[model samples]
Target: MPHDAKAAKAGTRPGGRSARVRTDVVTATLAELTEKGYDQLTVEAICHRAGVHKATVYRRWGGVDGLIADALALSADQPWPIPDTGNVDEDIQLLAREVYTTFTDPDLRTTPTALIGAALRSDLGAAALSAFFTARHQQAAEVVTRAVERGQLPADVDPVELVRAATAPLYHRLFITGEPLDERAAHRAAAAALLAARAGLFDAPAP
Candidate 1:
């Protein structure tokens, strides 16, 4: 059940041990989130499950929400290496795939859902959620803007708006409609947004 075996293996690559430690910590946090909900989750519980010392978790993450946020952020694949398929449609599809993959992971889903619920009930949670959403949106906007700069999208496209259109449907399905965000939905959302962007629907309003 230990998640750090690879870290302990002989001849493992440099950074492998540290990477595995981080992975174990994230995994433990996720497990705790699923089992106890965010309200009941604690740094001590995560440290216990990860088989790491309390000081290790504290020194690394600072506190419980900090640990949870880091774990959730890692669940999303890194944003760098965004594909350049020589076409806006292809790039949109790739971005959608990454979002869908991250959101659909069972373990990752619990943390976000719990966080959202907590946010609704607590001012501190609400503030944290606002910051988290802002960071996530900024990253998505950067990718959309890069596509625009590459001439794949119209010069006037509002990257932030385009990203919101692409992700709004998924949020509705997951949070409002209580439906699963399946592959078909992901493809439809991406394709629709890409088409609109191609047609200049995302163009900025007249000054």
Candidate 2:
């Protein structure tokens, strides 16, 4: 496909050719990272995948770290809405199901899984991964906050902790046991997390 068509398929957010090029490059960067990992990632490969010249990448990013960092930012910018159904149970269910859908998405899951794997091994990868998840968890934490506002959850419930609790099981299935991540699993995760949170399992301890 042509470069413009590739950029369009990559998902253009805004701006002109520069923005589209950056998007394409970042999309390519994530694809390469997911497929080949950080150790084997190269600008040449990413450029080839993106259908852009190597000079464009070199001129803009300077190196692999820069490219990965920008790609991580772009990944973070990708849309993932926080659930707000006004009821805690439903909210938690929405959160988990969204996570399941995202992780099960053939295009999205590999990117994040690869980034998470890279986080454990490389400093740059760790920074990128941390920034991405920190933002994501922070956004998801708002669901618990909204639940608290509605008296659906305890005032002292830790939002991020609740979010973490709700999502951990899905990651466990994805990375560890390799079991099926079905809708049933999503509902179970949300229910268990909300139950635990309601029981004060996620409440902060006395200092």
Best by lDDT: 2
Number of the predicted model whose TM-score against the real structure is largest: 2
Model 1 residue 183 lDDT score: 86
lDDT of each: 0.73, 0.83
What lDDT does candidate 2 reach at residue 162?
89
Segments of candidate 2 deviating more than 4 angstroms? 1-20, 33-40, 51-62, 105-110, 118-121, 176-180, 205-207
Stretch of 10 with least lDDT, candidate 2: 117-126
**Candidate 2 on 19-133: residue-level lDDT in tens?**
8899889888888988888799899999999999998899998878778777777778886777777787888888898889888888768887776665556567568777888
**What TM-score quantifies how close candidate 1 is to the native fold?**
0.64
Q: Score candidate 2 by lDDT.
A: 0.83
